[model samples]
Target: MQHSKLLYEKGILHNKKMLTQSQYSNFKFVARLDQIKTFTAGIKALLFAEHGAFMINEDGFTCTVEQGKCIQASLFMMPACFSEFYVDGVVHFNVNMNVLNECLSIFAGIDCTMKMLYKGPEAPLILVLEPQDECEISTECSIKTTAQEEPMEYSLDDNSSSLNVIFIRGPDLSNIFQEFDKSTEELEITISPRRPHFKIDTLGVMQSESSIEVAKSSDMILMFNCRETTKARYKSSLVRMTQKALSVASKVAIKTDLSGLMEMHFMLQDDSQAEVYIQFFITPLAEMD
Candidate 1:
């Protein structure tokens, strides 16, 4: 929020006498009571104090006239900053020095406490008198910037191709039995990197590795986990389980032909008294010479 227009609307352009002429424009802020604060409504006003950039709440509500670095600001070229009150009204604001002391007390147990501390616990501004020819008004201060830690980001390669992965959480023996017990799913188990190309089920070929946590079932949040020994990274095709009992074991003769093999058998494992879980990838092939 450039300070000029705020002054324009508030009928207070006369306050410009205090700004130190600089290339940077001062901030213009407007706010009203919470109930009356809106896009077009609010007790709007302009303040051109040297101690601009205030913070509000304990990092809750911040105003443009006195907000912090992380406080949301509008795009630089967007004509105005988003720092204005989302709703307007006469919400009271603390003075800069008081805000500093409050911030220090609240952040005492937080990380980066010292980094936020002001030199001698003073606010980042100086209260002073610029010589007025005949009279001196005493309501302004001067401010500057300080170093702080970087904000967080969760950026990933936007260009990476996404694969459709599935998961079977632990051991759903019912799903294991579904193969023979008359349950069916639109299922594509595993594809052969080597041909004859087809999905060959070694279902019920449970290993202790099938247990996993998938935040979303849409197959997007899950990514390739690196294999312990082979170090191969691939997204899980499934993340489900049947039961926790490992004693219940079942071996099934599946009707699918493995690549270059006439037969494929699937072994199912189970927990105490629960259902079973099936697991197997296509039989990896050796490269042709």
Candidate 2:
């Protein structure tokens, strides 16, 4: 069999010390290159904010970025994605997203193998990269860390009225976004149970300003559920951020509560063909008097 693009073998040197005395003990954290790439690609486009929280636990790892506390983007990689995951306590660090993404993708043309480890908060993130060739070259990078910030909480709970929820194909939303007026400051989204189930209205710039609506029975809307009429406006720039995620996602779920808090769930399949979700939360802009 051909060598895998990325390799991660347990007890692979430095991380061996992370193991416990018990034979059943496993490394608290160790992951492959694919997991690293997948998680990073999911949130890279939403890293408008300078800071990102790298959180680790038994469940797996999650990278979260927030924009002025108004928009929150998260990429979650499940425990199964890691080669070995065993965390007795939570580990969190505030790291520069741009720097981290650069380090992860540094090896572009070369078939690089990686080994990742996390000792604790006091220690920096350890990454080892080796080119899969006779070069016998490997590089290790230790990224410094900072205190983690508490993430914003969004309630999509049962109590919160899910005024509107739509499941649409990624390409469909991508196409619609192309027609959005970039010159507009805000974009209006209206969802109702009536004839025009979903609508997008753009203002500013005569030619770019246009209103598009899709009926509940439209093929593009795979699923539609709206209890009552709900209308909300969001910054055109903020809503446009989802364009990247929309391109990779197979299906997209758009949800808005009564408070105008919007949640967009992107369904993505990993290398293993397992389903994973990348969620984005955007708070609607205040109404103009």
Candidate 3:
């Protein structure tokens, strides 16, 4: 087996809307190296130890790294990760609440998390990642700066459980919008102005935007979106059927922990019955700012 390292500086991604699997289709991992870390064929156990600690520049902050400049993104750790580049010399990495939901949503297909926004990097940051074994987090660091809370958290739940959320956009199949520098990162879910019973927020998620938040109830949540009205009808019917198949699964999560059991089902057929189901699993993961 062979290992490779890549160095990315002031990445456009680190400054985009937000970085999530759903939003960023081609999520890949790259590491940095001195010369080369070679491994024999089938030797397995390819260990990638980031040379140092990591930090995410306080929101609108910045930093620079010496050697082990980084970002270790894996499904097992925090859902979303970010780093900063300052003119001085420091690299800031961080994970938070929103990123965690985005992470769980992509992996479990249902955002079923509640808390524990990761703050730093650590070995086996997540158990699921197969490549890098141990991650090194920087300690001697400081917040270079912070952005004006652009994607600030709202919704009055002291628990902030709503974050295990689903932002569903257009059944109209319209509108599309990634990032670490999430100062401007936004989640948009659109629904047809024609669709009934839809919690369509035409106000968008911003001052000049219009988006909808898919609601999760004691049982079901908006699992999928379709372009054609007929397909949505058919899919909705199938989802109802699936929900029935997993009847005991619909016991309602009053105070229950979703864990790995949350599942959302989505499928579209004809104009008759269409719907989608998103599986929600209270992930062992968390989101951070």
Candidate 4:
């Protein structure tokens, strides 16, 4: 009994020592004026899922959300977007995006400045926001973090077929997505270097089948790299998710691998005068028997 009591005391001391050491550890981050807003809007696009995981390193940060294991969305902000960034190594944690977003937006129209801090994996995300205004209000929030789960890795590079490409300006795609037949279960995407470079087919309400085709030489086709025909079908819901990223993107590239995984790369400009990318991946619907 005495030995057991001594062991317990030793464990308590060790924990206290560890806690003290962590308190002195430096993990600090600060974003420039417009970066906070841009980051906020970027992550908001992933609210389709309930939770999000953030991985932070010297390169900056990546926020990811997975849906029903069928789709994965990721937003990356490079180190250039931050005014100051310091971290020992990669830090990974999960959080409720809905709650964290709300907290981040608490201060509005006040020239808000933001800082994030984390001592270690076990610590909560510390946000210090201050608004430079006559009122001079500041807000602090501690968002609890959870263990990071291994994210699904899509082996898009392993596909054997040549890459099929479709380049469309964001505004054009946004307008096209708006016309998508939401009533349809899936959106069929067909691409070839032939006359009709791109084609989208869907069944509208009342079982009406409709298809929109874009000519290869059309002005909307910024770049086309498909030499072989590639036809794949994706869930309308998953395709629609890209609309959020498209809203802020200057342009987007819709590419498909041989295995039929679609990757949407969005080109978003940051206030730091550099471009940032947000990528979304959707698995193609299996062919119906």
Ranking by TM-score: 4, 2, 1, 3
Which regions in candidate 3 have their CA more than 4 angstroms from the true location? 1-195, 201-289
What global local distance difference test value does model 2 have?
A: 0.72
Ranked by lDDT, the better of candidates 1 and 4 is 4
Off by over 4 Å in 2: 1-28, 33-36, 109-113, 130-137, 205-208
Tens digits of lDDT, candidate 2, 10-122: 33342333333463233345555534455556757656778788788866777888888678888777777655555556778888877776776767645565666665665
- RMSD, one per candidate, in order: 22.4, 4.5, 20.2, 8.2
lDDT of 1 by residue, 1-289 (tens): 2233343344333344423223112322222121111211110111211232333222223333312221111101011222222222212222433333333333232222011111211224322221222133222223333432232221223233322222322133234433331122112333222331223232222322222222333232222221111201211222111121111224322222222111112233311222222222222233321
> Which 10-residue span in candidate 3 carries the lowest summed lDDT?
35-44
lDDT of 3 by residue, 1-289 (tens): 1000110122313323333344222222222111111101000111121121233222222111111211111111111121211112222343332332232233232211111112222312211111222232111111222222222111223253321222332222122111111232322122222343133222212434344433233123333232222101111112122232133222121111222112222222212121212122211122211
lDDT of 4 by residue, 185-263 (tens): 7788888778567898885557677788988787776887785787888888888887778899888888886577888
- Give Cα-based local distance difference scores for all models: 0.24, 0.72, 0.22, 0.74
lDDT of 3 at 205: 23
Clashes of each: 44, 0, 60, 0
Against the true structure, whose TM-score is highest? 4
Candidate 3's error at 20, in angstroms?
31
Error of 2 at 62 (Å): 1.2
Tell me each candidate's TM-score: 0.19, 0.84, 0.18, 0.85
TM-score of 1: 0.19
Could you say which candidate leads in lDDT?
Answer: 4
Which scores better on lDDT, 3 or 4? 4
